[model samples]
Target: MISLKKNEKWFWSGVVFIEMILFYSSSMTYKQQTSVPFLERYLRNKPLAGSLKHFGFNYGGKYQSIENDGYFHFVEFFVRKGAHFGTYLALGVLLCLALYTYFQKNNFLKILVPWLMATGLAAFDEFHQGLTGGRTPSVVDVILDSAGAFTGTLLVVVIVYFILRHKNMKKT
Candidate 1:
């Protein structure tokens, strides 16, 4: 049997929790996931509406379906993409922390493994989306998600390197 310290347990638990959320959300149809109604209500006050009214994103043909949705959809587009990036970023960080001991001596693996795992999750997410109605899976989204994961794992590597360097300086 494997033994885990308290911190390790926490990190692993977080990874599982986030993974569940990602999977659950992915399984939902785009219509089910839409936040437009909520956005509509919140922006009805006009002050907030005016500020973002003309805000636009020059999304490519891939997003043509949403391009005509006006301001609310524009905000939703960003919020959705931001969710994709941020969720995977957190997943990458938690995975790296949970697996740190296994890759202690191999700095390369320390960065690579978590990113790969997160990318795999992103790929699976796209696949799941395909199974849902009104959802079209995009390769571009997987790329965006992979970038987020890479950023996260690289952040962990840098932080650990600095901490080790500071400890060595203290010893000398």
Candidate 2:
């Protein structure tokens, strides 16, 4: 039996909640998944479209035109990948934070454990997607997810380093 400090308990609870959310989202059907991108496209066409177009995003594929056809599938592809990256990025950050908080004395464990956990989750996520009817799980996606996780963890490390540097400077 392991007893957790109050903050540790809260962090672990949050991590579990995030995992549930990700799992639930992964369980959505193909058609159900499209709904979010559809809504995003609709909203982008509204006033926001102009701002995005100015930045050369053009969801309609007019700016850089990654795909010639104006079909929403082209936009949806990028949107989906972006979602994968963003979600895993968040997962990585949260996991790193939790591990860092719990293992303040072990600096190596703080980084290594979170990366391993995030990598494992990314692999599991792709495997779960493979079981879904409309989803085709790919190793490429796992790579992307792992990349996002690493990016997030690296960001945390950089931020923490800066903070510690600032704190040490203040003492001088």
Candidate 3:
């Protein structure tokens, strides 16, 4: 096992915690995870409903398409997919941070490792969903999750590059 500094420990812990949440959420049925009722209660009263009404897309799931699912389900589909993106984005960041101590000078590995790991987790999560009732494993969701991880890792890479450049400049 590799010895970790205090900050690295925290970062690794965050990665583990996030992974646990992803796994736990994946084990649940779609109905258990639905936030549609909650969204309808609050969002319908807000001015955003008018703008959201025109925003439409077809989610061709096993049950029904978005056209048959109506407005609230359409919104819920986006919300659910957004959660997938955001959660994996966070996982990518945490994984990158945790691995930074080992890969500080290796830019390629720094970005690649975290993204691959996060994508692997996304794939695993989708597989786990396949085991749950009312849940469907989707390749599109895995792709979306990968996109999120890529965006996150790229963000970290860019930020670290600038920080390192600034430090080197100050040494002159």
Candidate 4:
């Protein structure tokens, strides 16, 4: 596989900006339907319609049958309801961007700055939605969104550390 590119903060920022925006929006949609038969209800509703469930279908018709496999079912279920899936995807992209910037020493302020910004931004988005006619603000969604950033950041740290160690080993 090809190695990650260096100092691609601008690239990552744009991607994170877009992905997290969708993540934040999908999260709001997910939050709006969190209750008994949450996924089923939301999947039937507009904006987050049943069509979104297709994302988890990497193997076409076979994987489309979420009922047969536990993991695939959960994946489809989340695609059908939870915000965690979007959270993880956006955060993973953010982490890649973060690593590129960090290595280039261009990640100004502190490393946690992006993470905090993402969390705060999502919280703000939810707050903004609260101002709308039918939308409501949710603290739970913000927490989950922040946790996504942490999960991604932690993964990046561990993976990068191991990669560096392996490179040093190869030189010895």
Candidate 5:
């Protein structure tokens, strides 16, 4: 078991709480006119659809194809997935930092513990979404969330390693 100092405990707890609030808010369905109209208006004029089509990227589906009325939907889908990735990335960072602060002796534990916690939270978020009125759970989303967590954790490890190395060099 790892014991955190008072300030460290408060900071990590705040991060976890913010992540939970973000997940809860995202579980709600956004009405089309609320924000989609604004995004659609912007994307329709940006040539983004044409650019994607030029790259041979086909957003295939009955309602999500590039040749049909799916351009906005395609863009929106990526935007939503990007949000999932980014949010999980932040969660991963906080978890990794918390674990590192308490378990500084084990490199493996730092990575493994944060990864497991973030992945579990992702699964729980998906399940919660499924219970919402218009949201459906997806295994692919869980995978994406896990990948984001891994990337974030790896980034933190690299950053901390370099910082520690620099500090040691300065000490000599």
Candidate 6:
């Protein structure tokens, strides 16, 4: 596990957030053969090894195949490509991060802030892809993006409950 510094939660969360969006972006950005070298490069790097292994664990085991026959399809007409499950995993983490950050924020607006922020980020990414020579934006991608934000937000609330419960127990 990567040692997370107390102040690095946002950074890690942003990384996950961007990567989740990039999942579909990269699919639109490159052909299958072209994407393999990058994955190879990532796998050979040590810091990424743990993440790589985890991806495989989530993907397949023992015999690692280059072909990602997993539920998330890399090929899509637009940026909304891939399995909804990948979105679930990443959004779950990001939401946990948001909820942690919002615990003491105390305004009802605090609840909407993360959702809006994620929506804007996802929208911007799709817009960026649309401007790119090879890609175009899709309403489906926007919807999926919102779905990811929703999933993330839900995760945060659940985690906060556990954290608070644990804290209460400790104090008792």
Q: Which candidate is the best by TM-score?
A: 3
Tens digits of per-residue lDDT, candidate 4, 1-172, equal: 0245544655467656766565455446434643435544654543433554344453322454333543334444445334543564366446545555444453332236656766776677667767655565667667766777666655665666688789989999
Looking at model 2, which ten-residue stretch has the lowest summed lDDT? 52-61
Runs with alpha carbons beyond 4 Å of true place in candidate 4: 1-10, 13-81, 92-96, 103-111
lDDT of each: 0.82, 0.70, 0.81, 0.55, 0.73, 0.52
Of candidates 3 and 1, the better by TM-score: 3
Candidate 5 vs. true structure, TM-score? 0.82
TM-score of 2: 0.74
Candidate 3 RMSD to the correct structure: 3.3
Candidate 4 lands at a TM-score of 0.54
User: What is the lDDT for 27 in model 5?
Assistant: 71
All candidates: TM-score: 0.85, 0.74, 0.87, 0.54, 0.82, 0.52
Please list the residue runs of candidate 1 whose C-alpha ends up more than 4 Å from where it truly belongs after superposition. 1-6, 45-60, 63-67
Error of 5 at 123 (Å): 0.1
* Cα distance off (Å), candidate 3, residue 55: 3.1
Encode model 1's per-residue lDDT on 64-126: one tens digit a residue.
Answer: 333367767767788898998898889888888888878888999989999999999899989
For each predicted model, how many residue pairs clash, with residues at least 3 apart or on different chains?
Answer: 0, 0, 0, 0, 0, 2
Better model by lDDT: candidate 1 vs candidate 2: 1
Q: Model 5 residue 142 lDDT? A: 88
Across 1-172, the per-residue lDDT of candidate 5 in tens digits comes to 2334435676588667957776766578656213457677776675666676543242222244455545676566678778878878888888887777766888777788898889998998888878877767877888888988888788888888798899889999
| 69 Cα displacement, candidate 2 (Å) | 6.9
Q: How do all the candidates rank in terms of lDDT, highest first?
A: 1, 3, 5, 2, 4, 6
Model 6 lDDT tens row, 130-163: 7766665766666676777766666656666587
